[model samples]
Target: MKPNEKQVNIELTCTEIGGLWGIFIQESMNIRFLTYFMHHLQDEEIKPLTKVALEISEGRLDKIKQIFIKENFPVPRGFAEDDVNLSAPPLFHDIFSLSYIYMMNRLAMINFSYTASNNVRLDVLDFFTECIHTSTEMFGKVVKMMLSKGIYDRPPKMEYPKEIEFVQKGSFLTGIVGKKRPLNAIELSEIFFNIERNYFSVLVMLGFAQVIKDKKLKNHVIRGKTLSEQQIKFFNNLMMEEDLLGTVPVGMEVTDSTSSPFSDKLIFSMINVLNSVDISLISHAMSVSMRTDLTAQYSKIIAEVMLYSKDTFDIVVEKKWLEQPPLVTNRKKLLNSD
Candidate 1:
């Protein structure tokens, strides 16, 4: 090899850049919430858990910053200390904080796994692989904490079938007609988790609605709460049809504090993220659901959530709170510019 040879490092692809940027923004927002929660946390049992979560988010942000710096890319201005008021009174209980950590870690695991699968760049792949591992570890810790505190909501258990069974009739696929069949294990599992997810959203929206100052934004959040309730009711009734009940996780409670702990922009961004994730979750649920009723109901829920998410996007744009993600070069526009 020639001593004068220089190594040509490959540049980041659009997907890799976008993934890191999105994760940076998300981690920044999460850091703010965790900081505030840490300030008000009273449960000694989960204090270390919350601290670990904060450390993980902060570490992720640092890694992203390093990557952007090395690549000579402009660092995104995500949420900051200014976006959260650490001195504000607690708007939710400690149990709710634990639940939030558990759910957020669950989401991080799902998203990071997908990002890892799509990116072939060595650095980006390694980063997401670490993210997946850390998120899974955090999720397990939160689950254990919830269980120890007697708040973990277990999914409904089915009785063991003594004999193997097969679908003998076409009624298994029919849900809207007379005398529909019972909910199968997979169908029941999907409905069960969706109910749990919406219930958490309902709690968060209720708290946000209470503290949001703008009448319009408050109303929008209230509408989100109502939508979550409606979705929960539908899932519950669907379960009742099979003579089974969906377990609603308890111990999450919002305080009476009307003061906002987060900036309006942060609040709306959080809502936007949650609603967008729900749309994806419900769509996936629809694909797995075999019963016509379940699929049809999931479709309707997706449509409603999509509309709600659109409003959130508009609000973020109108308020100039939306962060522009990385995009492909606009060759035509660049050529047209003076």
Candidate 2:
């Protein structure tokens, strides 16, 4: 290979290696958590299922280790002595644990799918395919459990709104002045659907925050919850214009269980902060493509939410749980100029 080609091959190999290690680490940590749950589980049916999962994970772990060894690569030290707490009380109930498992399996499948597509090595491709199959099977089991429990948390059904108005094309100065072209039902539905999806992500994150114990994190979660609620209302009103329902799925129940494998406060707080930032970024992009009036209103709402987020960040910094993100020195001037 040419020098550049050799470098590229090395980089790809390193990337694939890191990805494989990540999978191993995640699976090992999950297996540890499941093993702990197995000991504390009261339900006979669930216990067996947990045991089976644990075995499958352990088998996969062994296979990965063998692959590393065969390739003369150092195996990853996943979840060493300091990484697990065997003595800690069960942090989640059977149902919750199963749901978590299901979510993780889905994540694993996605990761493996991506890796399999990218890696040209036959051995790596085969390994990722095995991982994909394992996660798929685990996901199937969890979905079956969810079905049995009758807790499929599907979003509410919605139909197209009856009354539709054409959005008139116009310049920024003359609102709806130039051409009055009616929007089709499909176009209207797509806009509302995108809004609803955004709202749903925010609400679920909020619900998770409500039960978080850390005071700083609690504030952040609550702020996120409110932000999501406002967005939901905004979308709902927009749908009302078209006479359509814009309801998003909300988790019906939340657990206040104090026991947590990780820092509940930190996890919830991080989740809220990350999700808010993501939403803000998307909203900013959306504003560019949207009508001026719609953009202005959305920006105003986002600004308010961002203020709340800033307050929460302050709390986190005060508690010393997180380092403050870098601030722009000319933020005031930038906003004023805008």
Across 232-309, the per-residue lDDT of candidate 2 in tens digits comes to 687676656655565544344334544444444334344544456445444644445434445555667667766766
Candidate 2 off by > 4 Å: 1-12, 155-255, 263-338
- Encode model 1's per-residue lDDT on 108-151: one tens digit a residue: 99899888888877777888999999999999999998899888
Worst 10 residues of 2 by lDDT: 3-12
Count of clashes, each model: 0, 0
For model 2, state the Cα shift of residue 133 in Å: 1.8
Candidate lDDT (C-alpha), each: 0.88, 0.59
Local distance difference test, candidate 1: 0.88
TM-score of each model, in listed order: 0.95, 0.55
| Per-model C-alpha RMSD | 2.9, 9.6
TM-score of 1: 0.95
The CA lDDT at 185 in model 1 is 82
